[model samples]
Target: MSYLVLARKYRPRRFEDMVGQEVVTGVLRGAIEDDRVGHAYLFAGPRGTGKTTTARILAKALNCVKGPTPDPCGECERCLASDEGAEFDVIEIDAASNTSVNDVRELRESVGYAPVDSRYKVYIVDEVHMLSRAAFNALLKTLEEPPSHVKFLFATTELHKVPDTILSRCQVMRLSPIREEQIAGRLATVFDAEGVTAADGVAAELARRARGGMRDALSLADQLLALAGNSPQLADLARLSGGAGLQELLGLVDALGAGDRAAALDAVAAWAGREGELAGALLDVVRSIVVAGVCGAGSPHLEGGPAAGEALLARAKALGRGRLELMLADLIRARERMRHLAGSERVVLESALLELCTLEATMSLAELEARLASLEARLGGASVAGHTAGPASGGQLPVSIQPTPPPVGASATRSVQQPTGPATGPATAPGAAPRSPDTPQPAPGPAAAPALEPWKALVGALDARHRTLADLLRRSGKLQGSGSMARILVSKASADEQALLADKRSRRACERALSGAMGREITVEFVVGDAATPPPPKVEQDPFTRQVADLFDGHIEEP
Candidate 1:
């Protein structure tokens, strides 16, 4: 006899035999026992989760010869015939192959007839989502009000494709993927029954690789058995699956954490040479590292043994969490790209390893802040010392000496000169103070009064530094004071510009500029009111255009 694959050979013969689907099994069993069955039922979920199998089981429960029983008597001829796919009343259709309105119409017409031998006629439609829109519409009425003696079962991986009109007519049960531990336990039973002496870790690895699909897990185990013959060990399974040994993957991670690029690259090369599955190996290593970081060193459930777990913990400590997160993100991106780069797998894998090796191995954010603070202190001390050294003995500091003020004349000095007491000689003129031999007179203040609080100077600095902000501030108005607290009165025309000045950063900048101009600290305030008259909008000239005009001996117009 030909060897039967484990997937088919171990197919669940009874509801009790189904693994990791108790929710579905329990519901069906209750419905059967209570005789509260629906005319049409829909099962939806990921593949290999037993949707089709459950449909078959339900068929057997409904049509068994003994009675309409929850637990079908397998010994009976009707149940046995259904199990062998030879039952006359039970019909299994692959909707993916026959998805047309005509096919559905035929099904609808056939459902009118009663079962020949069984208690009810069962129609199981697999991949029902593949049906065309017209086909679904044709089946809708029949599904909603099928003959009393007929039952309909539909299974699909893509429930979204099934129209809501069709979905509302059936009872829907969503199936979940089987858990890894459950798959592992089932595989353990299979191994024991096959008289195979597999290592403890082998079944677990296969189960994880299956990604919660029992059929996939069973198929993978069957493949491993063929390659290793009976009594396969964990090490043998790992080698066959192109999976790097747990210890080796951990060592590679440690090398990367230490910033030992050469060692890390060498390890990657060795794994690539042995496994020829670089993407898979990289993904596995990345997954292990992430798990170890999250769960810590004592997690017994990690796919690789305890040694791999410890190595991951050590790497996590050495590399720090920030670097690990960045590396994981990079690996995820590389894994996605691997799908499209069919022929250049090795190049992609090596590039990912090189990136990992050159990862920024660094301390946590708090540690980095502390290191920066220390460096800044050292640099600040050096700057202070450099400033303390005096100018060279013969050298002089550059002094910006203003031209001696023109002898203060009567006309130019009157507006700013304070009234003087009786002049000692020649009766000094109106706006000029007389200087006495024994007492010198103080200098007159500015003609324009130097802007009450240097608010105009602050605005000028802002204009020079940032035109956008300056324009907004300019429309707002003139300064009203020169002391610590300075206020501006904005006209209604520019009230909308207040939002720009309200920003904390902009306010602080205005304060600094005001302080610099007035030679004292200053606070800024905005008051809304009508100004005497708004200032004319300043014109902006492009520097490049001005330079070109200068070269041509022409003036550039400001707009």
Candidate 2:
């Protein structure tokens, strides 16, 4: 006795027996019952998606002894013969081999003859697009106007290759790939019929591996039952699919979420040879994490089922949504990179996994903003304090702001609420609080104005003018006073910057910017700050500067 594969043994016997193609089957059933059946019908879809099976069902329905009923009597001699492809009138041709004009000419010649013992002389041609142009042309007339007792059925995986002339005469039915849920549902029924005891998620995983093909799903199920002897588990299915088991994959994701780089690298090393499959498995889990985050833990879309979703929810919360999204994007790009590579697939996959592992230490955008604000507050208060502590001996205090460029066209306004006013006022005698508003007010003393917040905005505003005089002033000098601003170009210049700033044109340029902002005729003065004052603290905190300095084995030559 020959062993029958599940794909053949469970082939759809009728229109209603098919899976995941309700729309097409419903139309076909209605057409048959309403006596609106077309002379030539074309079925198009992916391989193993019930294209030929549909054609045979329709043929059996038309040629049955019951005379063109949608529900054919399978026991009839004509129906049985048609099922076996041995009927005298129901002809089945494989266009892949018989694609010549002579074949079509023979078919055309035979169309004039009557059926042996059926309602219509049926012709089912599989992969009809493989026919030569000449063969299609030879059959065009016969196909368009076949005899009343003749009918034609054509099936093709590539509908685009079928010429429009042949297509215009035939009715087209497009079959869609079955969904994983639908495939798994069908597999459950098959498992019961076969008396197989498969674990939960095993059939679901097999259906997923089928990539939307029911026949492929059935074939994989048969192979799995044969290999594992009817008691297959998720691990067995994972091994068959050339990827890690769900638990192993979950562990890798956990390592990544916890920022355990070595653990993640070790896992990557363990799956070195199957990097592509490992990448796919990792992507699946990451996708589940995203789905769990957005669609909730109990959503049915989770690929690993509820157990995997529960496990993934913990990691999803640990890594947060943004980092998980970035990690998912990285995995997608890594898979694309390894698509055509002949070797070195492990490097790309490992790098992506390591990056995801490091995602735990990375700060979210909101967190980074909070840290920057805190630092800005501390640094701003410190700088304002240092400036307020003036020399008081006819000498001025230096207020240096940290140089950070506001991106182009951005608002550089920063409202620093602090009394950075000049310390030139005589200290009011201690405990002297009796001066009421009604009392005669003491005349204000004369002193230089303090560097205001708008000055920093002016400097930061010139980010578009990088590596120029504007950049030099932002990096070194400080703008003080209001309308008659003092443009103190410091001694930190590299000789060329000094020449550029000391130039009259540069002074006028600064005065114009300051004047327009201050709404008055601004006079600029260039002077280096006295050595008694110090530069702003933490001004050299830009890591890029430090990296470039290290790379060049040099320091920022500030005087």
Candidate 3:
């Protein structure tokens, strides 16, 4: 075939030509320029991050006829052959297929030979980690110290698989994943070179789809060119890439933000059916929302177009920070689970979306805490404006604050103060008024009244917040005692409610509600019967008495 793919046609011919790998190329260039090139070199990173390509470029630089220069003259006979991958001196081997001790022995024997034409005999091994232990051991000595005319270039995606012994013998270079901007800039250059007309955003979209791999971006660009011919638009790129369109992704987010479970599920189902990586696309949108929430505005920092980003930002704000975080976490988990799940990706993805849509139903602790904070703020605002008084009125103080009573059974008695100003609490209800300080004090006899007051206030507070839970507590029992020791008499209707409240989370929530209402920490216990009254004891009867009872069909009664 006469046609060359973009990946090969645009392959970096010189160290300076490599993209998004300045460090690796700079080091190699300096090594060649200073004539300090090592006998063995290892390049490692993710796939399509220029490991093998850099190795090839390094090989060419060393073998060029114009001495060991970083810049190889493309017109030179040796450089031309090396670029063509046909040079007799620069041999490229796929270690994946040639992973044997015998192969290493053959390679070792060839390393000692002088170059047929080039200055240096370069051996490039791709996927070097695939070689077996025996193969590695066989080549260790040769790699550690090779002939003056010979050079070894090794490339691997998994650096950890390379033995430390092998690693110690070579100059290792770590390459990082290419950034999106770098990939997009490279794509734009390719587009211009090919005489293809594309929007600026088109290249960026393709770059994002590449997921930090330059080769992937170029390959995708090639596909887009073929599909759209000479003039490719952003829509064409999205269609060819099998990615969820901006509108579709935005619709999904809107559905979730609106709590429309069915719509969200439908969106997932459609996206899953059409796109290869539905969950990943959804995760991207969700992650963008989380970022936008943090930024507190709709910034066009995400992969999509401006309008889509704005819409997403608006939805993110409407959904609030807590819901966005939960949604983000759910999407991430679903994507991970999809990897291990077979033939059920759509089901899992839809289920995850639906779950996120109904996040309000399953309130997380973080959400509850945020709600409580808002409630506290409102209450605090109300408390500050509760009372005001003038000094001219009989020299009475304007502000009166009520101090909570001390624990029951304490020797000291604390009096409740009446504010001369308006009251703000529930105690200031229509008929209820604060007692005057001069009024005769009521004697405290039973501890039940004080103990029950807090519990009643707690029930009312719970009712205002969570009605169902408050109802459950109302049926649970009546308060029986005071102070550090108080009890609730459990009835038959509250058995199930009590069991449910026994959960650690539920119990803690109840305790928090009680503490907030009472303004102090108090211990509560559940009792089955009356705490003050004792049950009757049973007496055993003699055998004759039992026989007499049996004859009359009567049972003995306990006293």
Q: In candidate 3, what are the lDDT values of residues 1-559, reduced to their tens digit? A: 7879999999999988899999999998998889899989999998889998998888888888785789988879888998898999888989999999999999999998898898889899999999999999999979777899998899999999999999999999999988877888898888899898897588888877776778888888888888998888877865785566656677887776655655765665456454237777777777777776666444546654566567767877677776677677878887777777776566566556645644533345565456556555544443333234222212222221222232232222111111122232222221111122233222222334444344544455454434444565565444433333333333322222322333223334445555554555534443333222222212212222222223233211221
- The lDDT of each candidate is 0.64, 0.66, 0.64
lDDT of 3 at 303: 55
**Residue 199 shift from truth in candidate 3, angstroms:** 2.1
TM-score of model 1 vs. true structure? 0.57
Q: Work out the TM-score per prediction.
A: 0.57, 0.55, 0.60
- Alpha-carbon RMSD to native, per candidate: 19.3, 16.8, 17.0
Which numbered prediction scores highest in TM-score against the true structure? 3
Any idea what lDDT model 1 has? 0.64
The CA root-mean-square deviation of candidate 1, after full C-alpha superposition on the true structure, stands at: 19.3
Clashes of each: 2, 0, 0
Q: Local error of candidate 3 at 541, Å?
A: 51
Clashes of 3: 0
Best lDDT goes to which candidate?
Answer: 2
